[model samples]
Target: MGKYEQLAKDIIKNVGGKENVLSLTHCVTRLRFQLKDEGKANTDVLKNMDGVVTVMQTAGQYQVVIGNHVPDVFKDVCEVAGISGGEGSGEKVKRKFSEAALDIISGIFMPSIGILCASGILKGVNIILDMAGLIPAASGLGQILAGAADAMFWFFPIILGFNAFKKLGGNPYLGMTLGAALCYPALQGVNLNVLGFNVNATYTSTMLPILVMSFIAVPMEKWLNKVVPDVVKTFVVPAVVLFVCVPVGFCLIGPAANEVGAIINNVIQGAYGFSPIVAGILLGFLWQLLVMVGCHVLVVLPMMMGLMAGEPQPLMAVVAFPSFVQTGAVFAIWLKSKNKKLKTIALPAWISGIFGVTEPAIYGVTLPNGKQFILTCVGAGVIGGLSVLLGVSQFTMGGMGVFALPAMIDPANGSGSIISAVIVAVAAIVIGFIIAFVTYKDKKEAVIENKEEKLVKGREVICSPLNGNVLPLSEAKDDAFAQGLLGNGVAIDPADGKVVSPVDGTVMTLFPTKHAIGLVSDNGAEILIHLGMDTVKLDGKYFEAHVKQGDKVKKGDVLVTCDVEAIKAEGYSMITPVIVTNTADYLDVVEMASGTVKAGDDIISCLN
Candidate 1:
């Protein structure tokens, strides 16, 4: 069995089983599921499951956050659930128009994003090497590399056709055949008189025409399948699809789609040309927000159409710095935070953001803090507007972050644009860092406690595990704890780092990180003590365990010791939560301590 087989099975079971799934797709860190009925999924169980990060329902996609290794889990899920081609055997549930459009766009493009970005990077590098005079454009090595870099874009119609047809539930090879015919060399600039109608258009590097052709071909192929004999159906359907699609595409779709693309490009360029700075500021400020909601791809489609039609994209250039802006904010957090766990997440997120992947930085650090995310957007807007004022624009699609700078180098315009790009990126990072560092504040919880009550008979008394001020679990920064999703509990702003046993019990689980421990009391009470919020990311740093899993322990026995000052210095909150994981197993769990607590003082009473 695969490593994620069991996890995949569990996910399938909780997500209303395989029968409820309409389709499944994935991007980077999430498994996007389109379900027949969203209400049937067990969201809470999936959230608390091991190996899962979180779950989200947005844009008509039930998203399962599975971290970076989501692809592996997605594969295992498909295998275990008998899901072929990521589509389930059921009629798709009707979705809102906007949601359906977003799903269709994502399905068509997401599968190709990685290769597209890699190709863009290669093209950018080739341009740099040629400009440097190290590899002249006419040199054999340069020509070979140029071909490799340009092939994907030059033949993009065929690629788009294959993906589009597959997404629409049609045969992909037929789509490819139609796309190939459109790009045939003899057809370029050819004027054909078919019933006194002139059909002349160049289809190389085009997008919209093939997309239209694929949509038309699916229904045509379906109609042919019904009339054709079974023995010759395969060959006849494909033959008919190609013959009909190619001419219709060239005669009608190609010319019309080209004009439509031109109109859209002209409008965008006109608006951008009217006030470059305002356009820049607006795009930069809203780009990340659009990305958060998965609507950014809709914006990219028109820009891509324009780029392929030989138009400059100043708007994309302006919005390019948002990732770097996020990087800057994460850097500030890394420098300012004393929490080892947060610092650990921040550093890597910052690094990935620099490489043009900001999901880690956005979801992991900035968005969670709220203020820092806004500061980064403000920084991006300022830099984006400045970039326009300084005359920066992109001539071609390129890789993100630092790798995108090469696209700013307009061979006809000298080095001015590239210089502007560098200035904007550096300024964004510096400004974002300064703004976030000065304005960002760590979360602080107010301490409040109920009046003390004496433990009564037929109840179990659990003592305080650490010296601390009392805090209600409802006020915890973590949603799973604050909402009581993990079970009823109260939190503590620890005055000391020592974690002692609260009852005579056996250690049920000791987390490898040493940041949490679980015990089963002799009186049938289950207790879980978590040392800090997100402290698991610390990976055992500054934590020492005195007892291992399955060890027998009595009340007041020291179970673990943490470096209080060191953890605080690292910027981690030492607000610990002692939860009764099996809260339903008892009558009620009540708080017994008020205001402050010392180890060995009764802090909770589990009523029988």
Candidate 2:
């Protein structure tokens, strides 16, 4: 098979086929997919598949974590799915929903974070062991663990170089070669100095510059790989380019780039040094927003530098607030909401937040609705500002969260700073909760009154078409839906059954297996209900229908019915989804309480 053909097949198989995919997007480390049916995408199948390291469904996307070559994988997925790979607009999709995605984001960073903590503990142990004259610095287990722990930093360039190359859709090993050149032994010994002063140059554990360069290099590699002809190009072009490019990069590019990074770091440190309080507030509000854009990595480079330099960086002191505040804000929403589905997601987000992964809380909960995000930010900023002014500090480098408390206590500086940080964070949560509570008007009262007064015309909102659970559409696993790539609506927890309209509307279309149904509401809003994951395996056996395409459905109308228990027996979730396909056309899509909803129930109401 042709290389392109093989690549296409690999992407298709992991994504659950052309039909299962909703959309695809890419970031530094992942190819994010929003799928029509997440269950249809076989995790085990994808895991065992070649070129795949792990499949992570996080932040409401089925992320095929193909290690560093995720960009290539993403390109292949786009090719196979016949979709264009564009700088995706941050639009929201309405057809997908996910609980696992949120959980993964909130939890995925834990293992790495735990290892980081373990390494810190070991470093401290080594310090004590040496001070007490017990073991030498060359102790085997200690040295080995230290190396393992520090490897991510020591060789960040090489790792990211390989990753960036793959992401740009090129020869991954070639990318590694480029990274190796950056850290070459010959280059290490070379130096550029000014006025007899040794220029500070250490790439051993530096971040950002090399990785940034890799982004440029990977695309170059791909272009070179494709345009260069086979005959003498392989040996001649590569060898010549290596000889020329490596020197140019180190002699000219590397020094300038490294200096720029240093300048940025110094500027930030200077800002913090000027007024730690201001730094705390500014970073607390903006740090998460930067994280969303992937620019937060730039900020982190400086923090890593501070750890290496053994200095107190104000950013580190305030870093834990945003993560904690997101969890707090989400917890408040979960408690305030009557939605059982929200509770399920919020609970996991809360737990994950304690471990320092806030992606889930940020993407799945905070950003979806504008207000809560603002509240969380304000809360985090207030807390962070107070933390800095109060002289909070972290002695060790660790993930930011509850588990990170140990590292925050500097034995030399004492534990006062750690206590102050927690106090500030908790206070911020309380204030944020109050803000959120005040902002959340009694929508329930409005819903109850509308029902009692029959204000809901024949236009009663429909239940989710599928039967697993009702969830926020923003949390969909499919990218087309998660990033709002598709038009507005909500996602259903798909389970087998006849899909009913949530409102009095014309039937748009029913999918072949009766696994999905589409409708146009009286308001001209589009909606879809997709059934259980891979329940397609049933091949319409357990599916039943009362209406055909174009049939009219009133609120609470009997649209379809299936043996819910049988669907469960097949290992599918009974959770159902109710969607509003054209939510953008309206001012707001007011979802009903997020629990066991019934047909003809007011699933969502719209405002113009």
Candidate 3:
């Protein structure tokens, strides 16, 4: 009942009052949900909701992109909705076969990636030290540090088991027990007989073994839960499960998983061996496009890890630097835009993209602008292919380009991988920058406001745009206007049909019919002054435009003059809705005065 309680409740209500939510989990920046009905979500309201960056339905999961503080929000969301805040994984979501496969891989492996990345980074640090002769690999200190760094992968099944169990809604320790059984130290030794079966294969640091083990073990755990009595469940579940699952796991599951692993390893190795350049080009170019079409950034996770059983990973190398391409595109828009809204989204998104967060850039900037996104993709593809040609490859999982530099460094040899990565990143950034900067012509376009740009801070006092009797937006006959979808502000029954500027700023848009004018204030709020319901039908018959698009105007300056009597005689609604098109940017929009006033009378309070 604190900071995020209300927000959580609002989110739940809008997501179909918790009934529609089949499962819930969260990643670093997203609230990933498996919903019973995707259609039930009030996506518009959630997207407009404060604290939410955007709403996305991707890879068969509904993702609410909430940067940084998702964990806290996710906890509140679970508590408020009375659903398991399970690590957003393992639900049987409805999706295409490929997407379903990717979803399962991501959902199961995602929660444990933090451990993998941490271990990888630690190992990378040791690599730097060990290679530089700062620490001898055989020394006691080196051994301890190496153990600390390598533990995650050395006994990966255990870590994966814990996360996968939580994801599958089973007792996590049991999953750990199963993992330990697969990677049991004794099993790694020469021929070991377990339960009259000769166990030969060792399952260490491989993906398929633990997955196959769980494919059998998790379901077994679920079956056990149903049949086992409550009184004996405590001792019986583990006692019987470990007894049966362990030996069967060693004899059956482990061997099958190894075979699958070998097949996948061969396939990936063969592909890279065939052509790294082509693979890199395809991955780099399509990665952002995939993201645009609802593929999560981690969609290539399985491919990267699966390939890691043997081959050097080109997936990460090709994909990492391309983010700079998106950053570059947004930066271009920021530099070129005259409209405050586009500039605002672009500037922040561009800054965030440099540090390896591209959602802001993709969702906020490029994706909306067709040409700009295409240019960014072109730059990324060229740079990405060039990176592979320069021998840029990732040795371990890490963040985007600069952040992934350490991971890119070869652990076995002090190779110039990081050097190559740096060059690739720089090239990508430069290429993307040039492409986006030159390709995007802002001459006439810069003046147009980004339709999706929300209102800015300030502009709290909105003076009446016309001499009119103020009314709520509900007075409008049109559903979109009355529902405040266009924005929040009061409708007015005009005393005089002269529409004046509500805020001192540039007129960003003037509709051809002269029925509406969009303005950007000095402070940044976007105001849309719609003359009246269906006024466009009059086709300038009863309306006279006083300002052209892109004209800078002050408050009280006449925007358009209309004849109320003439419009009424023509059958158009006389109620003019003076709406702030980006009202979602503000905390509240209050009607300050309902009855009467002259133009420039502050009638609405746009609270922040």
Candidate 4:
């Protein structure tokens, strides 16, 4: 089997098997799974497994922090375990506030982000054409492109309806139909012109009304599906549902919701008018946090509606700061990290950030590391607040990106809001650099533990048996290591003539070649110690052992020590692998007191 595949299986089993999982999802750097029963999970066991950064239960998902390679690991886990659905269940539903927030943010922004980015890029291209005089102000091409760009905003409900429906476990087509009723051409033409007053009742591109309509539609559809008789339920229920839902959705639901949505919008608009800087600071700092909870899209809808009405919404400008700030933060990390692997990841994250794709940056670099992410948010918020004071405004309906900046610029009004956007962008970048620079102390790099050193009772230590550069299991040369088959562990080599027990345990097995040993600790944890890098080539030769399979030993007991220099002279890396063969049962793995020593020192301390 491939390296990662084997490793995935080992980790999966360690986490209490596929049945233990209730649901599974992935962000840029983590595989978020919910367990069927947390009581049965050994998170600490999973955490110490090779290639894992940490394990957290938050926002209803069991998160495995595996960094940029999470998707690959997730896929491997699902395939091996025959997982069909996305979430794993525990005995009861448990809530994780942080994960819930993150999940919400992903839900709200991830769906339409690609569309907005594409539109922004196209808008930029159109601006270029206009600047170069290639497309006249009234050119058909310009109009067509502009119209294409506006289409998504105008019909955002239809798009959101599908996504929201999926999120809520309802049929998307029905949800879409419910949204279409609100913006239907005939319904939009219903205007009130009484007393010689022309008041537009247009609902095109409106956000709040359609969302309100969805709340009703989802429940109404669910009731209908449940109540309808078996045979004719499908046909009869849909027909009846459409007849009842469409009319109500338009007549009472859409308009009333529209009015309510407008009131909320008006309140925000008035507040912003009173203090743009305050609004910008609040919005910029909180926008990403809102995304984490899936409510950010709710904010986007109102802005889209303002765009549809051809009004320059201050909310648009307020949000632009965070989008740019995420990029700045990622760039700072990319420039600062000296690790080649981290540098490789940070580069792509930076590129994605430029296109206004912040998920990769947020998950891959920021959130995992903790401090850099907080700095990004605070630094960006400051820039946004300042931009508000500078009277920066953007007319564009799309989210932040260089392509959207020109659309924000208004030649007719000479608003100079686009310039404000530029200042904020530049300021945010500067702030991010300062924060990251100040925080960029090179922490300890990845290290593998060796098994041939001293061990004390009741102490935690890794017994790595091979020697080579400590590669992350995800990047290991061996298929078993790559797939996490060996558990939360690292590759190491025999540093001396003897291998010793890092914990008090019974020897489970001693391979015939004396190249590998398996032990079960008193705490019921299983460990494997494999000697030498690429020792499979030695076919277990030149290896000797003091202990046999099934012998009970205390911590620091002599197990096996090999000729390290001789092994190296024979062209094998003395790198070893110390692993918890079963890891998925716990909550996390914590590295104990550090500053390095020889073999058999405490390495990974488990937390349940």
User: Per-prediction TM-score, please?
Assistant: 0.75, 0.62, 0.72, 0.65
Please report the TM-score between candidate 1 and the true structure: 0.75
Sorted by lDDT (best first), the order is 1, 3, 4, 2
Clashes of 2: 35
**CA deviation > 4 Å runs, candidate 4:** 1-110, 135-140, 191-201, 282-376, 394-415, 438-440, 443-464, 467-608
The better-scoring model by TM-score among 2 and 4 is: 4
- Residue 371 of model 4: what lDDT? 74
lDDT of 4 at 362: 67
Candidate 2 stretches greater than 4 Å from native: 1-140, 168-170, 181-201, 208-237, 273-275, 288-312, 332-345, 359-371, 392-400, 403-442, 446-502, 508-512, 524-534, 539-608
Write candidate 1's Cα lDDT for 1-608 as tens digits. 47888679879988999999887878767788888888999885576544566677888878887766788999998888898544775576789998888787887877766666677677767777888899977899999998887787778888888888777788888878888888888988888898799887998888888988888899899889999999999899998888788888899988898888899999998998898899889889998887676668788888888878777788878868888889888999899986444575677789878877787677667876777888888888888798888888887777778977877777576477888889989988898889889987654312234454564556788889999887877666775566444556678898988889999999987867898888899988888898987777678999999999889999999999999889888888888888887665665566666678899988887777
Worst 10 residues of 2 by lDDT: 102-111
Clashes of each: 6, 35, 1, 76
* Segments in model 1 whose C-alpha atoms lie over 4 Å from true places: 1-3, 49-51, 84-86, 411-414, 445-608
Colliding residue pairs in candidate 3:
25-88
lDDT of 2 by residue, 1-608 (tens): 23335545656765667766655555544566666677777674454333453466544567664433455666766776676442122233454334433322222222233345665555545545544567655788657755765665555566655555443444556656766777665556556564454543556555455555555555555566677887766765556556755555555566677777667668877888898888889888887776564345446646755664455666876876787777777777777866444455466666666666666566545655667788788878887788788777766666556655555655464446667767866776676667666664322323345543324323334455434456776566443344332333455554445555567788776645675567787768777665654454566778887889889888667677778778888887544445565554555556654655544445566655
How displaced is residue 168 in candidate 2, in Å? Answer: 4.1
What is the alpha-carbon lDDT of model 4 when measured against the actual structure?
0.64
- Ten contiguous residues with the weakest lDDT in model 4: 588-597
Ranked by lDDT, the better of candidates 1 and 2 is 1
TM-score of 2: 0.62
Best by TM-score: 1
